[model samples]
Target: MHYALAPRTFLFSHYFATGLRIATGIIGLTFLAYFIADLPTAVAVAMGALCTSLMDMPSPLRHKFNEMLAGVLLCSVVALLVSLSSQVEWLLFTVIVLVSFLASMMVVYGRKAMPLQFAALFVMMLSSEAPSTPLQALRHAALFFAGGAGYMAYAMVVVWRLQRRLKQQVLAEALYELANYTNMKAGCYDIEAGLPAQMEKLVRGQSVLAERQQASRDLILRGRPTPDEEILVQVHYAMFDLYELVLATHTDYELLRQHFAKGTILPLLGDLIGKAARDIEAVAYAMTRNQPSRSNVDYGPELAALDAVLRDVPVGEGEDYDAQAALRATANKIRDVIAMIGRLHAATQASHGALPLVPHTDMTPFLTQQRYSLGILVSNLRWSSPVFRFALRVAMAILAGLVLSRWLPYTSHGYWTALTIAVILKPSFSLTKQRRADRLIGTLIGCMITAVILHFVHTPAILIGFLFVATAAAPAFLSIKYRYTAVAASVQALLLIGLTVPHGGSGVSERLLDTLLGTLIATFFSYVLPSWEYHNLPRLVDAVLDANRKYIDAAADLLLKRTGDDVQYRVSRKRFMDSLATLSAALGRMLDEPADKRRAPDELNRFTVQNYLLVAHMAALRLLMQRYAENLPAREVETALEAMFAEVRASLGAAHEAVPAQAAGQSTWIAAWPGWAPLQRRLRLLQRDAAQVAQSRTAIGAALGRD
Candidate 1:
């Protein structure tokens, strides 16, 4: 928790673990070949191993295996194709461009088939510098394939062993969020605190729950369902249940403080919830250590106190006392939540009961859906696809750089321009921009370090040592920060070029100039066909609204406890979650854009906050319905609430709010319901809130729609 460590905390943990694993795999395969064979063979195999290792991201072992295999095949094919066509300049150029396009399009499949494969294609492009016969190309490609295969085998085993640890880590993260939510809940009783601030924290809690839910879903979906994995299934299922139970979490500071400001039981809820949170923290520690949980958690006293208070509390008189009724409902809800926590405590015990050191894998596709079909590949060619546009942009830049590098009379530094274009231009404008900056900074730092070493340390052995260290460190930093990766990689490249070619610091100056040229080329090409998030926001917002609308309808029906509705409810839930994720991604991209281009940033942020609040409110309603069969605002008031939400939903995709005059009698109907009528006022407030968001939406559309 020290201030200094907070900035670099992300550099450790899995990044460290996986970095060490892949670095060892890459360097080990490399040296093994080096000791037994010639330098070219050793370099080819090492390059193959390093490339494959880079693709080994966090995922199910099955996907890791496929990723490694794809790397091997793609590398071999690219090498063979380039070598075969090297005799014809035009043929080689066309082949590389087409292959690059296809390789980049692979990402349309899913997260599993992305940047790794793209890197593989470019590594092959770099390999074209080697002049070779077809037979030599095949031999080199085979060695590369063997290197990739060896590393793949090692990675599969390592991941298979480490997956249990990964799941435990996920469990700890859930508990961590549980602590945050509980602490937030405990502090939400301040009547004078800002409502917006309190709501933000509350929404954050739901967001945490959403993440836990996704983790559980991934766990269950990772492999085949069978009796052998029953314990793991139970653990994942418990997470889903825990997320649902936690969803009933909400508190209005003003209402609660007014009710308990002078009462003796003012700290009752906090006392109970705080104790439960500590118990979860203990379980989290056990999970972190991969140890069995302590058998007796004993939140019994807190639960007992809560039960006693709930038993003794009286309902107040008069229709003016609906607030009191709402307060009682909130108290009862807390009691139910305490019981749920006890269940989660028990589930934690059962999960730890059979914690296996090594887990099993089975017949799961590399991705949920097949992404390699001919149709999918062809479909990605449209301008609507960002990946396609990016691939085209990079290909165009590469070809132009090559032609201009020759005509500029600086053929020696020409490859640098293309190298920069390949490495820096990513799928999004903001990403490419960030990478460009990071690449320049990292390269400059790395070039300076290399210059110092080359000036003083001319011994071959020491230089090789530095090169080896840099090579090993590159993949490690790639996962943590691209800037660090770039630094290490640039240093390695400069060291190799200096030692092999015997240049007197010429490599350093050339790299700097080449980098500068590359940056200029990349920055210009980025504006060619930018995929700005501002233009994409409406679709993302609409998707979230549509998905949540379906979720609300299905959830409402489920609260009615109808049978045969479970299947539809689940489908709706997944869509709602997926849409939310997409919206978050778009927002992230929008925030990352140049400030001048980011119109209405404050409004966009508020829109996100409002959506999060909506999610928290809906979750609370669902939990209350499931636990107590209680209609939150009564069945009659729900009609008006749903109607209001409908207007809000329609406002998301359009530039104007839905008309209010059609609902002439909504206020009158709401007035008839004295028990939960106040919820109607919240609904009306939400409707009015939509108007502000709509205005911002119009302004953004105007800016982005300009040609």
Candidate 2:
């Protein structure tokens, strides 16, 4: 289905919902305070709400509440402290630097704490709006706390009421990404899109899919779901299995195109896969609307057509035979996908059965773990730590921005420069550069748009409506697209100031000037103690190898009947996928960096693809074993697989070592075992892929000047 056709599905998304909640809280509190008390009180309350709202992310209820509460308390305290010291210029400067450092340092605590940290820094910047006496500052802080707490309470209640719906939203999001991933894979058969480009797109999509799946896991796999929420849990499980099937569908696209360039089967296969993707998307759309999904397309015709085309192919030997086998396997995988979609649709209507009880002991490991302790912060205090360097960067940038702002004519709004710096500067140079560009362009566009509106229309009600929309759109798009967020934020900030402060003009020119200055400062400082992506490639490569090693062992264990599909095996698989995704993401960022900073682009790309194939081969092997375990010679197959696994493990462990010729040629015996031909073929493919990975690893070592 075309996404443009289903506007409500996108509107009901988790990101939009979060933004709308934040907008409602901010606008509701601001206008309510304005009408009941005064404009200043309304501004104070709105600032508080906005600060706390930054910490509102998709998480478990307990974490969400605690994090927002921490945001409210910290922001209020920061505002109060900064306000109390505002009378003394040097003291205020000291406070700003110290707060900036500490807040930026919170990255050591991981992602969840990031918003809380930013909330504190944000309030400090906002606190610079007006200097206040100690008594008046305390009153302002109290009002800030009131707005924050009030919004927190309101958000929690709203979340609680819609908790189930929220869970559905998150799960549906994963399905949406999975659909997108599948669609991207379908592009591989187009032949015209180019294999290298399609693979790059697929790799990037994998990272996004990994993130979405993790989010779904974090939410859906947390506490045991109630009976009413069981369908979501089931769909969640089915989605991951679907993702695995999609991964298993990976094959030599170059080979397929080379062999089938003149055939109709390739296009038919791509069309079928495309239809399957749409099927998944339709399910996601239904889930988003809290409705049961009914399949609207029949795949039988396409599958039959594919099968008929395959039947006409010569199936003796050579590339034609290999291509035929690959096409048949892919068609079967697609059939399985369509069947799984059917089951998934039924799952939305009613519970299939009780999901396997996840062991409590496995819960912590399954969900992304974050250590919220002082020790983590303390350990990251060293200069070698990226967080430490980032904190320093932020502090120095804030100081520079503050110093530069003092010389500007609009010195009263000098905090805008610092705020821009705070928002633009990130840990990595690539991200900072991207944010800098987005901030400048977004701010420029937003300024012109706001200026136009303010020039032509002066109706208070109309102006307030625009302000509400800009505010809502700001946080809503922050996670989705930061450029859009930047634009909305620019509009919102200008509108807020124009409405609140007396004789305040559009501030368009000032906004542009401050943003330009901020971006330049950010760009300059990004090179200061920057964390290069190449610096992390070796560790990430090792991580991928290690995870793959563990994954192979897990699959070996399962095949040998040494273990069931237990938590250990699941964790191993997850870590492998996660590591591969992490490596892919880092490579993506590295590509965006200076060309000189990119180490072994071709080698790294090969390494990433080899590792990806390794996982797919393992998944396909596991699936084969599961389906054919009853008929296969388990003992003999295990014995052969053990030898193969050892060779793969040794190659992974010693990056410089090539796969031994004897082991690489050991697949001859696989054909001798006629009873387990399917498993043998998978094992052979796995060995081949493992050797390629070893070669890629050795090349990476050479490129990186590693011994």
The whole-model C-alpha lDDT of candidate 1 against the native structure comes to 0.64
User: lDDT of all predictions, in order shown?
Assistant: 0.64, 0.82
TM-score of each: 0.76, 0.95
Candidate 2 lDDT, 532-561, residue by residue in tens: 898898999999998998988887787677
Q: Estimate candidate 2's alpha-carbon lDDT, on a 0 to 1 scale.
A: 0.82
Residue 73 error, candidate 2, Å: 1.7
Runs of candidate 1 with Cα error greater than 4 angstroms are 1-12, 87-91, 170-216, 224-235, 245-286, 293-346, 351-370, 383-385, 403-416, 449-473, 476-480, 492-509, 564-571, 594-606, 626-707
Q: C-alpha displacement of 344 in model 2, angstroms?
A: 1.1
